[model samples]
Target: MPVTQAPITPTYADSPPGPPVLELTGISKRFNGIHALNDVGLTIRAGEVMALIGENGAGKSTMVKTLTGIYQPDAGSILLDGKPVVLKSPQEAMQAGITAVHQETVMFDELSVAENIYVGRQPTRAGGRIDWRRIEQEAEALFARLEVALPVRARVKDLSVAQRHFVEIARALSQEARVVIMDEPTAALSQREIRELYRIIAQLKAAGTAVIFISHKFDEIFEVADRYTVLRDGRFVADGALSAITEAELVALMVGRAVNDAYPKAQAEIGGPLLEVDKLCHSTEFDQVSFTLRRGEILGFYGLVGAGRSEVMQAIFGMTPGVTGNVRLEGKPVAISTPSQAIAHGIAYVPEDRQHHGAHLTMPIQQNISLPILSKIGFFLRGHRAHETQIARHFAEQLELKASHLTQHVSELSGGNQQKVVLGKWLATDPKVIILDEPTKGIDIGSKAAVHRFISELVTRGLSVILVSSELPEVLGLADRVVVMQHGHVRRVFERGEATPEIVVAAASGIELESARQEENAA
Candidate 1:
């Protein structure tokens, strides 16, 4: 049977917090005279989940590194239970029972789950020989405690994003951590996976572990956190009990402005179908998928992870091999066997994994944006630097891309900015149909709103969009039509007026829909 969760309550609100297990008093850090953390102070008590909320580039990462001993603070002090201590290095921090689970789980891809869990501190038998059995047993015990199941001998690269996150949490627990700092733990998680993570957090709290929960998601904060701290532009804004604050106030504190209508999806004059996919099938991934993307329309594809949403898009974009389907652009049959062909046929795909598949991280923003239009710009790469800069600047302004300059390398930008760069690169192609897969993944709420507004703007300009996202709110708020997929098949298609959370979720999960159909047939 699947693990069932009880209705979550704010249990920590009943009792007053005891003395803190960890405290940061007047902590200050500067990089080249620019203050990242200026006189910042925080406290995390035993059995408490303290939410650290901030926007992207708001010094949250810096403060985390300071706590984990990646960088020594320029001033102020750290106190553990009122006792001052200096954490000079990551090793010392781990030894002191302070560990972190980063947003991006770092592990050896080639290593087994057990090996990755017990990487630095492997159990040893007599004669200092490695005890592989003990490692696997301990890893299994940890998963059992967390109510997660995975093969201990399986390689890390074979694991899904959610499973990798579990391994990271298990690794932190293996350190005997008194305090675990979880950085954006639910960024890539599905709704069900997020609930399970909350259950895990509850387990840790019951064990008297202090959790520093860092996330940009306010809903998760109010759900799991006992107390909240807000940071803005490298400065401390406020810290209070979760019960004593409202989400609007927290957002105001973080962004220094009130954000009204996060999803500003403007209605556009949707024209005839710009792209058509007829029974598109990919071997082992997705199969028998069909959809129509009309001009100036936002067509959303919603499904659970491993439901073949991304795979279908990849096949449509010519990224996957063994793809069998008929694709028509503007009602004309077009064979897209490669990305270059897709682009030539007025199609652009901004992939889900921007770091790996989308952007040239080491290259400057201008060059990255000019990549698709390199041949169009000039005869040679160096000859059109000026032309490239002009095109990059146009999109940067249109997209409201936040960066120091176009010459800045994409790698140095934050997650939101990097995503904008990826979007800019594709938008420069001036395609009629744009496929955005998880466009706002890992971005802050403010940036998400920005991206949403931009999508609306794109459609208003007579461009069609295929939005694929795990985020239900995004799909419901923006899509003119939503296609719910299950097990590589389009289960149901909901018009904008008909789709709701209840109906859409039921269709995607393959629950209630079949029963309702059976009842209708019986009648």
Candidate 2:
């Protein structure tokens, strides 16, 4: 597929210009005395893809919320088709031809694909009865237009993550939205799925739809976005065409400084096997899965979403039942039937869904960190204030978590800081084997580096780690060895010396190993 062309200039021409599809002028918003957006201005043209680039807590989400009417700006003027308009709610925004697809897929798992596509706005017949047939037919048509295939009657829960993303795009298109905002739409998608999404974006552009693409991935922006806008500390910093700047320049603009290395890989020594899984089988999610994790070694599980990577971890962590396997710690087979059991065995798992699994939104950082290791300090029946303080202090300094005190609520912290608190909680447990799933998702570069360093340090201290990540570069940088999975089975394993981006990708895609390597080298 042909890549989309970048915009010719940063700002539109002063006097000679076409009418903007949407515009936000001098937009400002504040939450509890914190400025979320400061005089931010943006103008999106029809048939163009504008990338909203920023670090976590950089006001990208806030701006998107304002645009979609999720949050009304304290001061601003919105113009649609060169005319000022007031958008009071999300419904109003959609009626005005604006639609948003959030990072978290919002769909009824039990509902059929057709039902999900036309959820809130179902078709009606002459007698005002719901038109199921029409809904299914329309959904099929929408998917066809987007080049996505899905059974209209299939349950959403049965579809893969990438397929669900396609459904989201189809739903948006069905709404006849002229302006679409996709926030990290590719986060859960594989390379092939992302390429497909890019094709859909191209189709949208051809249909004169103004797309707002929000992502932290630099390569995707360069490949698909026409123009770029940077926000920092809730303020607009720069706006320009994608071709007018380089990746380094864009990073500098987004973070307000140069990032010498996005992936700062530190070297560590590998030791004998600390954790080993033999003949692990859990129903259909995994089968005969066997791997050995050495002390001070990072083992990466690289695969597409729904490739059984998370499922295997879930089973090993005892989050799921019906597993027949031999999990050994220091050459001793142990039974792990629950999370607590895994914890007792000196195993820690950082789940992929941080908001749902890692932190309690309403609880303070200290409480979240102290929850796991509460038994370690004694006073199980009584509160251990001193112990809590010591744990918080140790991690607050080590993780560079930004908070006035440990009493600060986890929800009050930024994405990066919340992630730090989660890591701090696990680190406090002193686990010999740590399973991290998507550790760097939605976090900034600085925080990612800090997390990477912590992982390296843990391994150096004789901790075995199972690293599951969607980012290929991260897997390549950190893993001493990589195991690729597809369709609920192990396809290939590559040692550190043999593992490259190409080899890993090929393995995951089910191509011949040697042929895949050659193809990668040729590229």
Candidate 3:
């Protein structure tokens, strides 16, 4: 099936003078019975930021994977500069002037920043030996071009998460890629970092490099995208210049329905604190961080990447060692030195990276769901299959997880489905307080709604939650109170009604919201 390209209105600074740098036509792909993509067509012009929006399982990822040679299309044709080309591997894609920065930063923690930047293609000197001095100088030059300041000689692990993300971008710029694909690039960045990234994108546009920007953030799309393309049900639905549409309309195109309301928050009555931390101090990540979570309340921790949000959750979950803190659950101090202790005391932590920490991908969904509470029923042989099945079925239905059965392998599921499994696993434990870090990252619109609904249900059941999210909307929508953190410390707190994107961004960037408000008031 051929997708009809919507007539683009001439609104921006006009199409570039050069030929289309990249073009894909009749791109079709499938896995088993699932049609991952259906005859998708796209064109990338020089010096333009093309935003791709879609629901989960909408084939946005499939199209990119095919373009980058991670998955060859079952049927399709790709043209580079009007000439047919076959990108059989990632190396081929890079050699063809196509590069990508994935949502997850890919780098070697043990290596120096310079080394990681130019890992495979290092500058060589005499005798074909790697030229260390030239590599450092070139890496520094790349960072300078992207307006990123970092020590090229420092180990990658020593830098902050946002810094590491910039290093990845610097690496891409080092290649001088003509077409760059950024998948949720700002998903883990602060407002300052995001602004810096937009500046770099502008530079790339000025340099005549085409950019494919993928994000769920509507404000970012409107702010940075030159044109927009929406995908739904593995097919292209709409495309045009950004100015041709409103945010609500764009969201409708992506989800294939009107989103009259993005946030569905309902106020809850205040009550006694269910969990409290008094003078919590970790060795280095944070100090004197004290807060409380109450029953039926959602407490949001907002911060830039590496601002100690995850570290705080770690301490509360008993994963951080050498922590001096007095924690009380229901007015009683409890000794929590490990995850088991924390779980026993009714605390659950859903980590940021589900692939690495949340669940076992190769295991059956039932096994993963029952793993956390396995000790109570004895290993796989405890005759708890009936009970486990019931629990898994309940959550699967609750989360609307798509799978054949509880015996299905989690690895075969989609990103959103896998996330539901992680959530189900934790919910089975029946914890008093749940700590969620980036719970909706990479999930599609439908799945994101399901997760939000689950959170609301949890709170209604009198379970307190501490949510750490990179998406500001999620924080504002779900949190009863918001705490903004910066450089490993709390910067400010906002009541439910006062939390806004502008206010949170200002706080995260180390600017006093009240001072700005006072200046505005005076004006």
Candidate 4:
């Protein structure tokens, strides 16, 4: 939302929220006879942030698409200010004062910031020429109003990830958007950036814009949203004020059951060392990184961002060149310089960026799942259709993947399902050692439980796993041993009993072990 010239006093802070600005009743959408959203209902009042709560595959993405006019609901009624309106296309939705900022920032990299803001509908001079100057002025005004200083003339590609998101918000403001949808906006943002976003949301609230905030982070929802709406299996379960319910109740409403443990560690017998890395070195990212993965063990590499945790894993998986490392599998030295070689040596890597690096979005689910093992079968799935389908279905079922059919494109699935598809593809290879980086980054709590269970099952089946994550609890709960990395080096390796949250976090931040213990003891 654009910053206003006047003082930003949130009108909704003390006063009660006003009437509904947007409402959806009896919304239902289907795909190949499968219900994506069934009889879903929602309401968003003016000057309020409504937290759209749901587990992955619980129709959050479908509702977002339906609301954005990317896909028209087969059965539903949308009301704008108490009057029913039809959103036939995205253009119509935008014209009707609704704009969406997706989790994945989609912008024209070649265009300037101002140009991107006014891309489709640019103001014109007398003869319909693009008013570049006016666009820049308006863009600057938007940033000024938001109190964010972004270079309006700079190319979009040159900006930071946070800046690009601000530009997206500025674009929505430029449209005079009355109702804005933010889907996991903080997924890629730093904590400071997230606080800035909260400030922006407050300003938008002050200006009376109804914001639909979609997120799987319960803390974030409770922090920013004024109200709550729950959807389970594509149906409305409840809606009310945030202060009226607890987080556990909200989770239960969204998932249809009580979650006993956020991280359900798998039980497996640990054997001798399965893989060992000695002095793993990258030119810039990391140095002298050494770790060991035992048989049937989940070895976790935990660190803050830019700690070279992912780079070390990538180098081990042979995706990074100029990586000098001595890798031994089951006490036998193995030389690998490419991903195929790594896979041939029983190594698999599930990357962090699932959309770009892990899964092929345009490919069918069956094809994507069978991609890693195509040589074991055949190409194009011509004569090996049954085998491919059988293998795909096996892992999809194990992963609890949701889809219309195995032939459906991965692009059409929700974010959590896409992550599952990527996992299914790599697991199809049946590798002895798998490196999973940020495996549950964008997935919901329920789906996360499913994934945690699956990872536990992997170790029980004798597959050694290396888990890298920025989430502290996940690493602490699931990993048999935690290897803390800071800046490019291993700070400490803690046994399961020794890896306390406070101590591990301090080590990861480059504090001395003794000091960490002292602080822990003091606390």
Off by over 4 Å in 3: 1-262, 378-383, 512-516, 519-523
TM-score of each: 0.57, 0.59, 0.60, 0.62
Report the C-alpha lDDT of model 3 over 1-523, residue by residue, as the tens digit.
1112334443544557778899888888877545778988888799989998775457878888887878888888999889998889988988888888887877899999999988998889989999999999999888887777899999998987678877877877887788999887886678988898899889999988999998756678878888887887788777778877765455445444322246566556668989998878887788888888888899998876557889989888999899997999999998898999999999999998999899999999999999998887666675689888888999899889999989999999988899999999998899999999899877777778888888867787778889998666678778889988876788778787666555565676554445447645775
Per-residue error (Å), model 4, residue 291: 8.2
Candidate ranking under lDDT, highest first, comes to 4, 1, 2, 3
Winner by lDDT: 4
lDDT over C-alpha atoms for residue 463 of model 2: 79
Lowest summed lDDT across 10 adjacent residues in model 2 is found at 1-10
Clashing pairs in 1: none
The clash numbers for all candidates, in the given order, read: 0, 0, 1, 1
Ranked by TM-score from best down, the candidates are 4, 3, 2, 1
Q: Each candidate's lDDT (Cα)? A: 0.83, 0.82, 0.81, 0.84
What does the lDDT come to for candidate 1?
A: 0.83
List, residue by residue over 1-523, the lDDT tens digit for candidate 4: 1111222122334325566899999999987556878998888888889989765457888998888889999998999999899988988999999999877789999999999999999999999998889999999999999999998989998987778889989999999998999998886788899999999999988888999998766667888899888887678878888876665455445434322367787789999998999999988889998888999999998876557898998888888999887999999999999999999999999999999999999999999999989899987657799999999999899999999999999999987889999999999988999999999876766677788889878999989999998766678778999999877899889888777665565576554445456655776
Candidate achieving the largest TM-score: 4
Clashing pairs in 4: 3-145
RMSD of 1: 9.2
lDDT for 387 (candidate 2) = 82
Candidate 2 stretches with Cα past 4 Å from truth are: 1-261, 380-383, 513-523
